[model samples]
Target: MEAPVSADKLRFLIYRFKERLWVKPLTFCLLSIAAVFFAKIIDGTPLAEHLPIIEQSSVETLLSIMASSMLVIATFSTGTMVNAYTSASNSSTPRSVSLIIADDVSQNALSTFVGAFIFSVVAITSLKNAFYGDAGVFMLFVLTCTVFAIVILTFIRWVDSIARLGRVGSTIQKVEDAAMKAIDHRLNNPRLGGFVQPNLTALKEQGAEPVYCEQTGYVQLVDMTKAQNWCEHHNACLHILVLPGDFVSPNNPVALIERTATNPTSNKASFESTEAAACEANDIIKVGHERSFEGDPRFGLIVLGEIAARALSPSVNDPGTAISIIGSYVRLFLCWAKKDEIRDKPTDEIVQFTRVSAPELNTKDMFNDAFSPIARDGANIIEVAIRMQKALQVIAKCENKDIQKYAQEQASIAYKKSMNTFQFEEDKGRLDETKWSD
Candidate 1:
């Protein structure tokens, strides 16, 4: 949940916007074109006079070589990226593919090569028109040399990054970093700096304006600021019905508006205002086909869990990856729980929390989302089950009761699933020997 799509307040939109495949390349293309314009403007300048001039044939040959090479490089990069995305979608969670494809190093490298190609093309086209004077040619020549150096450097880095792209551990780390940023934001603004939600009166059944969802999709974001300000303007309270990451249909309500205007008004006007507010609220709630990670920390957890699930599948059968993911899950939980502890502690710098009425991410939900699939897939494997148990036991030792409760609950489920999987007394006995409490 966040304010409307203002670049500063809408956290999720900012995250997605920055990672777009075109942002960097488009920017660099514009810069490259700007360079050509600057060269033309400075054609008679002293700066251009000091620049070295090359033969027209030499410039033409270089431009042709660069244009052709860059075209091939761009194609190769695109193909490689597609392969990486496909591999990540299959090997890791499908959700993870977004982050892998948006990686900075790869995107920048592609942008560099692509921009170089455009620069060469523009220069060659202008050359045919006889646009470049002696000074402009010298400037263009210097610029070409600079672009060449960048292409070489970027190609090296791009190769290094491609080698690790789509890897399970790398993808997991990326997901973890995203989750941590979201967790930090929540820890700072648990209520989104709004009023407490749990105690807020449920007015939807009591004549509140209903904001119906228009489509079936996950609730990606709710512009709480716009909604809150609108409600304030009308002397009403904006109540969010579904938080980000929750799936909804057209039948489901996204928010409920309770009219709290103290002035007695005609029923006709009141009804009109309430309906208008509902319409505006609907505009503020942004639903999308896929869940995003900006405000939804659970998305990261779910993705990491999916990675473990794939590893435990019979076809992939990689217990080591499962074990590694168990540790990762534990670390992720500790990060979340530790932040909760920090936020709860009283300090001079701490301000009173504005506890907005949104769904609290339950420890049980995290446990179920992260472990159930793994438990189901690795039921027959004792080693995986043991690692799962130990991972839970570690979290269970923490003082957080919800964490302990969830850890114990998943532990019981893991054991029960193993009960059916183990045919012999020895395997069953081995599982039973260790205790979640201990």
Candidate 2:
């Protein structure tokens, strides 16, 4: 049992915060303000004497120019980003807009522009108010020049990146990357640091108490660490009923808790303990309005599937994009199969949370999420169907039994769909040639 999420809780929170459009820019703005004042510390230092004298007027003029130019650039960049976001939402699935918005280049470029503008304004104000002596002005001058070089380099890089930021190819790649990352994490921590859950019905029959969620939403992050702690505290075993990306309501139970046979508590005390522990167990599960990329590998696959469906829509009718998505699906599943092989081999896969039991992600469900929509939508297009079958053919060759099984299943579905939809015998015959082998 790898306690990845225990450390990841903080990392996950930080990742969520970084996803917001304002966070990086706000950070840069504060740093910019601090930089202006920081240079002031050099004013009375002996090192100030070694610093070449820079005229206050020259520095002031440069700051004024930078301030005005950066403001305009920032405004223009913002509008462009908005347009890119709109383009992404329209061309790709709207779910992918979050990934585009969280793009490092775009965010860094925008943050630099905003931060530079603030830096200029602050520096100019300080200069006008005589806040810097000769030494400070010299140091500020060097800082100003450095800012200029960074802004120019960023602007150039940003222009190149903005050109393709929301384009279909770029957006598809982003989605694929996100999906791969999520899939890799899940493969590494198969049961999310818990033992395989034996049987839910059997456990419940043995007097396990189901812990119901207070609200209705998708399960975003299941802090397995917290669940482990709860189990340790009560000397009980916890069975996680819901995996990340599972929809839950007050009617649905998030987990089940059963007292261990070794526990010394009597029946009366155990019942009371269950009642008191229910709320604590519930808090370990974090629910949200929409599905998140973290903790939910299926969400990424679902998003990719949605994109392929959108491309196959009559309005878009982009079979090429659909084919590309199928290729991405192949890469993701192949990577998954490779990781599955590694996980199966005996290694230091430590079981830290002995009291926690979590369900493994179903390969069938993952295949359904990744391929079903594309199979349905692309049934009529021989190119997409051929490519999809071929992709499945490759995946079905993997040694991992689950991967091979599901890939074959999806291939069968896609083949049947093509048989029904193809108007020409030649098209059907072409797809048949790419069918998965035993």
Candidate 3:
């Protein structure tokens, strides 16, 4: 089924918002202020007489303690997060920093501390100003106690997570999880909910006009539903030329718009309509300065390869990390290969967007994006080479013929590279003997 354009936009917006460090803190701060004032609503209620009398001094002392302690904790937690981010960037690829920064537990812990501080300050100020009656004070006390309980729980959980937040293994795991998500989505919607792109030469020969964008950046998303709607209304078909992670500029066409029929001698009104539709086609595709993982499965694989390359560099001779990354590649490919098992038969005729054409992520491209760099960088390391060969052999056994072919091809390439670089004859012989069995 075709996903709505608004849904993609919304999900992307939410993802972008999550990457910002201040968003959660700001939201919590606002909610804290609201909570403090909400007690004022119960000031004149008849239940005030039944509510227990809470001493003002006790509340004042508790608020003071909370205000002071929370400020210190929030500042400390922020510094710790910054250090963890730096460690992740240094140990792994810098791209992994965003994943750590977007950690929900860390963000929630910081937000809670900040919110508690704000709540205490506001409550203290309101108490001094005599803003609350007996019942209101009691309600404020209850909220304050609940806030303390929450802070304690979040602190404990955050401490446990922060311990491994920036370690190399933790960073690699995060990247793998992200890659798994992207590959799964790609497998489920191979054509991104559109029909396979027809022949570009044929499309061009049929007078399909290219749609160019004014901005230069990577193509982050293509709104197929919008393109389908525009095509249906304008009596045209759209062929998307670029997928997510593809860099584009004004000189490069993002898609080709082909008209079903032409009226060369159309009136001025029709000409203006055609011009308007051409402009709308440009809006259907989204371009951004950076590649996003949401729409690009290959981006994750590329990042994982980068991490392994950095590990294999002379400064960081961590062959173990690189070998672990090889395992990750196999796991990701296995997840992708499960698509063949999911479908009982071929789905060549299953298409949701008849008017839109988009390309699918090719298996060769996936293997090249992920394994090529690792193979080139770690070719001489016997341990890394052996692991890569074994990983590929395991992948070659999967049911998907395309995956098997690519796996074998990558294995052969890695083997040749290792053979040329190995210092000893024994190492080469050992690698040669590690081939996939029949």
Candidate 4:
């Protein structure tokens, strides 16, 4: 006959143990069952006879099973506690003392006790069956493995953080000033100007042997007899000095028909007698002259050159300007390629011709032409131009207003010069190889 009070107290304690932290206990039970099943599968083999004596005996086997169960429970509880701490730290909510106390009572203290007890049971069980029967050695091995795994994971995370930090830093750094100067210098070169076909017969008769000059403002005219005859008959020597491929500045000399002593003298009496014939010849010459005058240099070049100049200028560090300039150039090139004169020429031919004639041009394949001077100098120019633009954009962001304004003006001038030169080339029929080359 147990006392009524004692029996009631015992029942209450049992109920409380079953209900308190029910989820964690249930999880432990499930893990234990899984471990038991795995052990049974491994031990039930035909080679069980050769198994260790401690593993064969029921008491030792049970201890080994308990050891595995304890290890799992300890690992699970430690991981859960770590996760909780991390989550709480990262949360945006304000921390309260009461909430912290409650968490410690319900989760930290209780869970740790449960986990540690399970691990102790498993460790003891494993030690009982271990070959050397050295519990300390087995325990040490388990601890070492756990620590090593944790260290490896932590190291990986640290490496990832470092990589992310590097990328962010680079993204925030400002642009350079030397880059802008280089870009402006390339874009504003006078060699990027337009072309003009000269009177070939007049030049030939004047004992002017065509001399190949390096950046001397003279581009050799090939197969331009038709254009030359027309200009000669019109009594106007075509301006070959301002050839479609040459870059021109306001200071560049204009092409003019100089009357040398070699030109035939006009006999007034003979001119009157054959006035209609002379007039007809003059008209033919005028038509030819008009045909030889191709309108506007390469629009693509003008737009791109201006963009490069502006982008590289120390006054403006705007990425929008670079993008805008690039976009405009792309559109203009596409449009120009579709024109009557350019339509028939291969893409390679057009690129080569433009690149060869204009050393400062920076578009892809600008130097494809064997005859283009750009092949020799274009890549260096382009690389420097790009660097300069980046540099200017960087410097502009940090510079004073007065300096910025001055830089802006300089950029504007360079841009205008580039555009003017490009336009001059486009107008002279350089964009269309058939019109100019033939």
Candidate 5:
């Protein structure tokens, strides 16, 4: 949406002129000057006998030559300006109908026409003396040329503008089409299947195992024989989970698993102890609730799997982090509702989650520190961040209270976590300061 750069404007101007600036202007100027001097060449010679005709006509001829010179100058200037304007407009990629309409091709055309008309008038004036001082005819010639030039320029300008507009429109349509295709590709890709891919290679390298299921919900029991068979074929361990029908709370065991020991003899005792410890941990946090949903228990399993993914990789690169954050926030609200004995209450019975009056952080200091490196890299990151922050603030004020509250809470948590992690990494010399810049 921003205007084209100065360099582009200059380049456009130069390109439009091409070789015409020097060739046309120099040729016209020299011819005009020679015509003026030609009057002297005829003076006091055998041509003096014809001096009356030449002298009488010389003034008009001189005027005509001068006009020609002026026309050349004007035409060159107009061409350069038009080229610059056209190039600049093309680069901007206007999005609005109003902006598209405002692209002033008419102005450029008018300038070009005026320049060409001036040149035509100058050239015609030089020949006026030969017309035996017929002023009306000379005036007519000049007027006709001017009108013709104007008409031609106007037509050219309109055609160019329309063509440019069409090109821009076509480009935008193509981009939109490509974006839609990309969305479709992502949605339909079999490998992804609307589910996050487990990093099986990483898990294997780390000596951890992943479990997969097609049906919804957690497994209540694993047929050991079947599990072992599957594991042997896939070179993986079997993961088991208890279903919700089983009476289990956050304080009860939800699942048990057997892992291949790293050492057969010396680690057998340690491996048993480790497995027992893991089972105890799972028992402590198992959800204790009746299965309210009729079908697809895999939904709950997927949710739990996603949560585990987030626990493993708590960063922006991890897709699970955003989901986990939102889910956790929702869970927190649910816990609050339960504590207030409003868990079964209708929507109207719930208190409106209004936005809290909170103090704004002093962003000036943060911007100063954050953007210093950006500035060094020849950018205005602070300016951009400040603009974005201001826009967000305005949006928050206008948004629904619940939405605003959720956004604010999420932002605060993300920022805090990011700062804490950054500090920890920096202290541990794990962060490269050079990489952080820009």
Candidate 6:
């Protein structure tokens, strides 16, 4: 499917681009090459003559140290990151690896480290060839000092970031950031900036024909532009039944189409054109079992659930992690609940003119997606249950009646679940009543 347009689309593209492990490193490498040449230009300038003096031997030694140490640092950083990813997958959830891998600080720190190494090697080569005079040599020494300082600072920060990179708390934070961004967008554009049409029953009564999915998997993205274009070209109205994060089955109806034919020949052409449009719409709707970072914010919620599930597993038995995940679930829900803007105004006339319809994502459905697994597995864990109850109670304060009711119901279920699991009244009593405190 063509990817969702506007803010969500741009955010998705930028995220994927920046998440690349090599992007910053490669960019730094190029900049290092530029800096080297830049230093050459500044070497013989009048400004270079007044630059602080430094010995040839000192620079040579510094270059050698940087060259050797950076290579080791590169290897070490790679190994550390690999280990972090492994640990996250084992202790937390594998789905979170993608978010952690995209950590901006970690990527930039690694990039600076690698870039410094390259700069040193090139600087050393320049020195060996006697490429600089006293001024150039002096400038190179200053640049090297700056590089050293950067290496030290970057190393310090990288150490701190890597320590928690794939840990449960960090993973939850990443998922929450992602989900909240999506939810906020959804809150503003409930129908995703498209038309607010009737349900499947209403559309079916209007003689709308169903468009079956070509493949079975999670609907990652829908190309609104392409789908709308297909409808416009065929003079049809397409009503979407599925959205991103929806699991589709092969030959299942994903959208229902209504043909608008005014001419008698157009009536016959309408059926044929509707079939063609359905095929094109299916092509426009990209589906796969693996959820993508683009289009859907719910994927992040699902991942947050994964973390809770893993934390509750017998091997991990980490209630704190589950609590953290539940907290993130609440944060995301609040963001979704309070959201009021679509985040991006439609850029094209077609989007505003088309009768294409997209459904609003329900908070209750996402609530279940993020918390049900933990509720199922960690019901017996007092801390997890209490935290979940409090989290829901906090959300209930939002004053949205339906959400409050849902929160109370989930809290009730949690209490009942704990009661069933606990043999002692003391354990059950601990959860029977939860104080509503921030």
- Model 5 C-alpha lDDT per residue in residues 288-372, reported as the tens digit of each score: 1222111112222222223323323324233332233233323322222222232234433331211101111122322222222
lDDT for each residue of candidate 3 in 268-355, tens digit (9 for 90 to 100): 2222455566678888888899998776888889999999999999999999999889889989999989867645435654466788
* Candidate 6 lDDT, 292-392, residue by residue in tens: 65557778888888888887889877888788778787777777656432324444521453658877677678767877888789888888888888898
lDDT values for all models = 0.77, 0.87, 0.87, 0.33, 0.34, 0.77
* C-alpha positional error of residue 158 in candidate 5 after TM-score superposition, expressed in Å: 20
Q: What does candidate 4's lDDT look like per residue over 219-291, in tens digits?
A: 2122223323433443333333433334433344323333223345742222222333223222211111111
TM-score of each: 0.88, 0.95, 0.94, 0.21, 0.21, 0.83
Which prediction has the highest TM-score against the true structure? 2
- Candidate 6 lowest-lDDT run of ten: 341-350
Lowest lDDT block of 10, candidate 5: 352-361
* lDDT agreement of model 1 with the native: 0.77
> How far out, in Å, is residue 41 in model 5?
39
- The residue ranges of model 4 lying beyond 4 angstroms of the native Cα positions read 1-239, 243-295, 298-300, 307-309, 312-315, 339-438
For model 2, where is the 10-residue window of minimal lDDT?
263-272
What value does the lDDT take at residue 20 in candidate 4?
Answer: 43
Q: After superposition, how far is residue 285 of candidate 3 from its true place, in Å?
A: 1.5
Ranking by TM-score: 2, 3, 1, 6, 5, 4
Comparing 4 with 6 on lDDT, the higher-scoring candidate is 6
Sorted by lDDT (best first), the order is 2, 3, 6, 1, 5, 4
Name the Cα RMSD for model 4: 32.2
Candidate 2, TM-score vs. the true structure?
A: 0.95
Off by over 4 Å in 2: 1-5, 262-273, 345-350
Instruction: Estimate the lDDT of model 6.
Output: 0.77
| Candidate 2 backbone collisions, by pair | 1-350, 1-351
